[model samples]
Target: MNWYVVYTKPKWEKKVAEQLKKSGIECYCPLITVMRQWSDRKKKVEVPLFNSFVFVQLPDSDRNLVFQSVGVVRYLFWLGKPAIVRDEEIKIIKKGLDGTDSCEITIVPFQIGDKIALDSGPFSTQTAIVQEVNNTHYVLVLESLGCVLKMKYK
Candidate 1:
């Protein structure tokens, strides 16, 4: 069986994943706990890491089984075929979210005015220029996109 990406209705990633599981289909919807502030109060909620997206592992012949779940729009495509998610990639996501304190991450030092390329997130593959650097955060300017991004260290 191969893992394929599924597009779900907005704000429905978790529901779709639950439905797929009930049908005996293996699925993964990575979630993160985020702090949300409202006018009245602030709360922490678990939200899908990738909005409107979920991953399902199923054989090619059983691909249509996913349609039985509501909110599932369609399989994500790449190069005119269904996008495949490698098992190792899935393991990495799981390990990162497990919060076991065993994962080690090293941040490479960047100097101001240095050119860099984003490897992940919504701006993946886009080149940016380092504009400012400080102890807590850094600013990047995406000239092609005409936007400035500020990333904070955790």
Candidate 2:
């Protein structure tokens, strides 16, 4: 079996990972705990280390099974081929997320329209879809009322 990256629908990483495991597929979805603030209180929440992506261990023969899994969009391709994730790289990711490595957390490249919550700040726990990303900051829109929030993290 080889490690492959599966791209999932927005915010579906955790659900997809659980579904894959329930289907007897070997998979890894790294998560990190971060402080979330609400107007009333603060709490720790688990978020995907890499948004919308899950790592699965399977042979080429099982590709169809993964495709049929819930929330799976497609396999990530590079250079016109399926990108194979190395075992060592997976280990590194685990270590990094585990805080056993120099980096404490991993932030995947996020796209506009991506759903996210503020990890640390006065406005935490506010779930919003990304409308813009400019370097370390983001413009997010609260879906219900179309309110906008601009946040920056160092």
Per lDDT, the best of the predicted structures is 1
lDDT of 2: 0.87
> Per-residue CA lDDT of candidate 2, range 93-151, in tens?
88777765454477787689898876766666677899998888988898765689877
**Residue 37 in candidate 2, Cα distance off native in Å:** 1.6
Candidate 1 lDDT over residue span 1-154, tens digit each? 8999999999999999999999999999999999999999999999999999999999999999999999999999999999999999999999989999666789889999999999989999999999999999989999999999999978
Q: What would the TM-scores of all predictions be?
A: 0.68, 0.63
lDDT of each: 0.96, 0.87
In candidate 2, which residue ranges exceed 4 Å CA deviation?
100-154
Clashing pairs in 2: none
N/CA/C clash count, model 1: 0
Clashing pairs in 1: none
